[model samples]
Target: TVQALLRESDNYIPQVEKIKYEVGNGTFVDDGGIYIRWINDIVRYGMYASKTFQRRDILGVYSGLVTRQLTDLEYAWEFNYLVDVKDEEDKKIRVCIDAKHMGNYMRFANHRDTNQNGDQLYVVYNDLWHVLYIAQAEIKLHEQIFVNYGQGYWENKKKYDF
Candidate 1:
């Protein structure tokens, strides 16, 4: 199956960005890093890119525990995605990925209002179970990456404690 594996890895690239963090009142003196911080329970997470990314560049991929879905309802997890997979019996099964236990650097990125600039990245290949965070704009050095959580997510959720 070497050929098959190589075919899949070809679909992805060497991850271009690294996920980093800072603490309260700490000066962001470090160079070539991305940072995430929490203030009074509000996530002020930001990504400081060490390299620039062109539009449509794959930022990162989301991978985690895949389990059977309990209908179309969103699964309870900080970062996750839903997709369908075929069972051994050739039947379709809706799956909910619990990314809380496993994910890449993009998991640390913040969520922005869709109308703002959340579209910077998006989830792709839902059915294939490989969710990618693609850059929607020309990202410059020292910029943060954000993705739209969508109205469906906002309508039923409170993102943080303010």
Candidate 2:
């Protein structure tokens, strides 16, 4: 039902300011800039904080192509980047953002079975849905940004041997 898929409108442009980070010793020292690093051979890549971030700090936006379709190629691995979200309406509709091809560094954030350091918030602006990351705990420098991707995602991963 590609016809049912809605295209995002560019008419509503939000005036977002760029976040600045203080560099010290070749790394971000303040405001907690984030970066992607190699976690391990199994986990592959993961996101890390450059500085300390207190609980409830706004980390960043989880930007990507909003879609609902899961193609065969995506099912093999890109499926891991698919995140479910709710629309802004009286009756919410479940949708997902495919971050495989198009997304910011937030896509590198890894999943944690326990002790999640970050949480996702579905915020609505001008009827458009956006995923914002909030620090659930005190995230220190060089710490992994762990998010609970939920049980549903794990179950799907197991089915595909991902």
Candidate 3:
């Protein structure tokens, strides 16, 4: 069905007509070698040349991702941790992160720890999602935390003396 439609469309016009138009307009040569002369003209001069000009907004909206705003601290924490999950290729999973969404996750008790005078603390939890296993773990910010995923220790916090 699609093949038939494509054949009938202007883009898939008969080869004979296409060749004639090309030849007559000097788009094609007959020196034992066919050279496209009107290629630039065809691309530059046209009312219905591209689909983008016809449906730019629809294309933009379709390409955009739908996101929900977060209003709770707990939800924010979960969202933050989940957002850290990245592909092995280091690509971000979320298409976009809004301020509200970030704020929700910022409410985590350990999101950014500070002292009485707002001095940054030495202890911090940096959780990351493993792409292959889809598991989350917390690693100490300034310390090395060994994770034993095979042993089912996802969030086991052990101090590394070394």
Whole-model lDDT, model 2: 0.62
Tens-digit lDDT track of model 2 for 44-135: 88899998889977777777776666332221122223334444654444456777777777878877777899986554455565666778
Candidate 1 lDDT, tens digit per residue, 39-114?
Answer: 3345644544556878766555554566664332332233233323567997876555555555445556666765
Off by over 4 Å in 3: 1-75, 78-84, 87-91, 95-113, 116-162
Candidates 1 and 2: which is better by lDDT? Answer: 2
Off by over 4 Å in 2: 1-32, 71-94, 159-162
Best prediction by TM-score: 2
Among these predictions, the greatest lDDT belongs to 2
Error of model 3, residue 147, in angstroms: 23
Kindly report the root-mean-square deviation of model 1 from the true structure over all alpha carbons: 9.4
Q: What is the lDDT of residue 93 in candidate 1?
A: 60
Error of 2 at 28 (Å): 17
The order by descending TM-score is 2, 1, 3
TM per candidate comes to: 0.55, 0.65, 0.13
Span of 10 residues, lowest total lDDT, candidate 3 = 55-64
By the TM-score metric, which is better: model 2 or model 3? Answer: 2
